[model samples]
Target: MKKLAVVNGKIIDVEKGSILQKNLFIEDGKIVEVSEKEPDNSWEILDASDCYVAPGIFDMHVHLRDPGYEYKEDINTGLRAAVEGGVTRVAAMPNTNPVNDNISVTEYMIEKAEALFLAELYPIAAITMGQKGETLTEMGLLAEAGAVGFSDDGLPVENAEVMRRALEYASLFDKPIIAHEEDKNLSGDGVINEGRISTLMGLPGIPSTAEEAMIARDVLLAGYTGGKLHICHVSTKGSVEIIRWAKKRGIPVTAEAAIHHLTLTEEDLYKAGYNTNFKMNPPLRTEEDIDALYKGLADGTIDAIVTDHAPHSKSDKEVEFDKAPFGIIGLQTLLPLSLRLWKENILTLPELFKKLAYNPARILNIPGGSIKVGEPAYITVFNMEKYTFTEGMILSKSKNSPFIGWKLEGKKKFIIVKDKVL
Candidate 1:
């Protein structure tokens, strides 16, 4: 294979929290060297003098509504969106039409990703059959067929006994049960956060207790079963405290926070005139919750940052706030929105990269989140001050994002994954 060299970029060492100017050399899909000296002229060159080079992003939660809902997003389009956002890998949630509860569906996703060969796609199988909250799926079989983890995302596994059994079963395979923690009863008909904002708009609210209550139960169950539990899209301050306590007690638990939750708040909903694009499950929370999330992220209470990139068509998002479906597409907006953390000094550059790249790879037990010799060539290059984001810049099939028209601080320049530059 021909050798590739990336020259003059600021290489971020997330593990060590440092940044240094270095040139990288790659051959046969693995990095061969990273040094201050320029590489030989025989190697092909990719200039990065104006950008920062880091590990390609790995998003642990995404919704690629393929098979059943292509109009929203399919693997082909969704993976492209991921690549466009400098993401080299993503863990797709199993909430498709046939509900990925079996081996066949799991294999299909793997096979499809292999065929496309853009960004790496890891499948997360459904926890229960049909996601009905009744019987558990074939965990062993699903894992054997390439499922990275299990979750019934978009729908919480409400039955306590079922969730307990699922946790126990998943523990046998050393896999995590990605809990979409929420008490449906408490969140019933709620469109946004349960607080002054919801009341002022005369809309029903989804209490923070709904999320914290379920997290409290699952953390206990995970401790009792000794299972690896990963909580998804953590939005409440109370939930963060529970996870910190669980970690302190040495219970195997990890949690993630979405970029939207970190940057925007419930005040954005009113500012947007109750636009559906600002509406999402676990809705944009309050400033207090956002503050706590930042603290959790900084202190290691939150393990990773994810997009939860739920795509919806124009018709799906054009309805009234109460009638429209939850979620806004996020794959393309993750980096720019996340850059706000570094821009505001909430997190240092390396610290932000840890949440975006290293932690997600560790949580999913995947390869390719480091810039080291002999490591796979998964790199993302970006210029922090050169670009701006707009609605027209979205590459996804859907354009339902609150960040549209906002001037973002960073721009992705190149994505190199497994010897291929995209």
Candidate 2:
């Protein structure tokens, strides 16, 4: 690999929550120097003028529907989407065809990602066998096979006993049980948030209690069992309060808020006139919920921001709103959408990258969340610029995002993943 230099950029120092004007030099896939001096003629140059150079983004919660659901998204296209979105490390949910419940499936995902050499993929194995919520899977064996964590993401673990066991078992391997918190009984056939909109539309509504109740239960379980608990896609004001309370008590809990939940509201969904692309599990809530989520991120109650990145084929999302699958492709829009936080002053640039990169790395115990000498050169260079997001710009096989054709800020100029630049 040729030595490369990134020059004339403002480097975000996430560790210190500051930015510095500096240049970086890389060789043999690792950062060889961080200094003010420019590299000589022998080095290849990447001009980063008028851009922010930050650690590579790590999206901890994403659904890469490989294995049996390649029609929706495969590893190849999924990772491609990831890199384009400036994400260099991704932790994929274990909701594939076979559910990623065993060693073979776990090994296959890891091997496939290694071969692709795009954004580093970390497989999160399922907490229960086939996600049935009855029996636990082989967490020990799966961890040995390179599974970073365990989750039954698309399906919530309804049984408290089962959930408690999963938390405890995952703790033994020093891994987190990433929970999809929802009380199915409360959520019951609901297509959107429970409020005026649901009543006016004459559709069943999913009350905030459905999510808050489960988060409450799981956090207490984590406290009792001394296990690591990570709540996924927290969507309610009540849920944020619960996570904040849990963190105050130091109950071994962490949580993430999805980009859509943080930015969009049920009002947007209603205005979209039943567009299935706006549909997602734990559905979009109100502006009140969005405000609470922003506070959660600002105060460290929410540790990371994720896309969920659930991709379904065009045919899969063309059905009636309630009948269609819940999810929208988000990989290609993660960075630009997330920059809204920084632009709005909810978080500074360094603080934003901490959630986007540093915190996720710490949660999953993975690498590539920081830039420093002697570390692998995983970096992203981007600028805040307005651009219209078009369907044609989507690199993922799926085209289900609601943000297409929307004017958005933040564009990734390029990403350096080890020795290769994309």
Candidate 3:
């Protein structure tokens, strides 16, 4: 029996919203005990003094660009970056070159991640064939092949009937249809949020209504069909109010706010003088949107926080702001950036972990989110160590992030995934 003990740590009880100083004992990848009792000499010890031990973060929204965009980020490099960010499980978005719309691509991603033995990878299959937003893929077969959920993340399902049918169909498998809520007609050729900044910069804008309108439609569809719905990268105040109203009406819906959306705004983009790194889909909205996101999070309207960790190669982002792809690499900065929420008292420690670790697991139906006996021992140990986020700190294949020079806190000391310590 392989035995290990994590000692001298402040273990977070996400359920009770409390912390306890306990030592965690693991035997053959399963947590065998959680107490103050010292382990015998036979068991290996992993010290966690002065650090908080919580369940490994499960980032449900990430683009690991493998099997096609390896130049940007393959599974190996992506998973390594995930571990570095204190994440143990990730749900990869389906926007590969051929797209993960079939069983083969789904299985390939799972097998590749398993072989690496790094952070667990769950594939989110495409909602439409080739993600064209018309015909639906064989979601049942893809789910059977190990797809945890379905999504057309990089694109929105444009047809209302198609989306309604998708919601109804996905409900059959009890999987969430993660909607990338955007109306192409409203956001045509837009490069940033539709407001003062865009007008001043002479750039087209992606109106907040483009995101809000689709979210409203989908939430209503979810209510009508009783299908599970998870909104992706919600960035607008109106979007939050819509989701909150949906939940009040008892719509089967959940939502996430990206770290960038929760922190940065279009004003930051304007300040940066049209930096492409600040550019992303559902482009950063106004500070008013950020405040609403916080309110939504505090009130439980927003269910989780995600990185939307889209990575683009240097060559891919070295273009004019409008010509650049919409995303910035975020795996390496997720922890520190998110820790700001807890440090600022926007959320308590357990509340933060609920969004970072617990909620993602619950939303994706994955086997993680807590530390307890008889559970898989996937834990992240970290301290509130201040540090500057630099290019050297990024472990991702791509070096495209706006937070490269930001000073941040919360460093991961070690992450225990099953029986392996990283």
Candidate 4:
């Protein structure tokens, strides 16, 4: 690949723990140098004067329903959505029509993703066979097949012994056990969060203890088994507090607050008579919980932010809000919502990049979260002043994003892959 220079932008090296206003030189799909003095014209220049050029964004949790559910999303369109969302890399959840439970299935996903455009997709294989939670899948083989991590995702390993074993085994490969964290009996047939909203709406409610109980148990399991545990799509204030307490006590635990949980409250569920878009597992909580989610983000209690990027068809979410599938698409809205946090001064821009890029990359052990020399040329350029978000412009296959038609500041202008920028 020929050398190329991206000039006149604020370069934020999230992993390097610094930012610089300079020109970046890329060669062979990796950063070769970063210098303040724009040198002689020996390379192609990508104009970035009005943009913030940082390491490509990373989403540690996204459901790119592929293989069995191509009608919803495939590797092709899912990746396009990822890049359009400024995500250069995503660790996809294991829940699918036929779960990615073995080495062969995991390998097929890796092979197909390589033949596509947009951000890189790293498959997270299922932790159990069929996600039944009875027997553990072949961890070593799956990891060798290029599995980024392991999770049951939609289904938590309800068996404490099974959960404990999954964590212990995954530790051997240095991969984290991503727990969905809901006790089966507690969340069974539960709809919205167990609170006033559930009572007011006449919907079944899942107790916050449903999530917190599992989290508390998992922290104990991690402490006992000596394994790394990561909590995904944490929604409850109780879940947040447990993760904070566990982390403070030095348990190997990290948690992420979902975008919707951060920005929206139970009030959105009541809007339009309990909108289905507001329906999600660990369902939307009260204003106090939303405040706690923000507090978690600001105080560094929640280690990262995740999209949970679940997509359902129009028919899927068109059902009654009570019966609709859980989750809303957000890979496209993560950055802008994060910008809201930044604008409120709850999180600095560098801190925003750390949650969106750096910390998640560290947790996943991926390498695209920095602008340091010799790192892969995964980068994103965004306009700081252009505050516009239009509907149907997102590149994802399913347009079920809750951020639809909601205006947001900050926009990604272009991205750099290996030899190309768009």
lDDT of candidates 1 onward, in order: 0.90, 0.91, 0.92, 0.84
lDDT of 3 by residue, 1-422 (tens): 88999999999978789899999999999898999899889999999999999988888999999889999999999999999999888899999978999999999999999999899999999999999999999999998999988999878899999999998998888899999999999999999999999999999999999999999999999999999999999999999999999999999899999999988999999999978999999899998999999999999999999999999998999998889999988877888888899887788888888998898888877676888788888898999999888899889999999998899899889898889998
Cα misplacement distance, residue 258 of candidate 1 (Å): 0.5
Tell me model 3's lDDT, rounded to 2 decimals.
Answer: 0.92
Model 4, residue 9: C-alpha shift (Å): 0.6
How much does candidate 3 score in TM-score? 0.98
Q: Can you give the TM-score per candidate against the true fold?
A: 0.98, 0.98, 0.98, 0.96
Each model's total of backbone clashes: 0, 0, 0, 0
lDDT of 3 at 153: 89
Candidate 4 colliding pairs, count: 0
The C-alpha stretches of model 2 lying farther than 4 A from their native spots are none
lDDT of 1 by residue, 277-352 (tens): 9999989999999999999999999988999999999999998889998998889889888888898888998999
Question: Once model 1 is optimally superposed onto the true structure by TM-score, how far is the C-alpha of residue 273 displaced, in angstroms?
Answer: 1.2
Name the lDDT value of residue 347 in candidate 1: 91
Worst 10 residues of 2 by lDDT: 365-374
The local lDDT score (0 to 100) that residue 34 gets in candidate 4 is: 90
User: Clashing residue pairs, candidate 4?
Assistant: none
lDDT of 3 at 420: 90
Worst ten-residue run, lDDT, model 1? 384-393
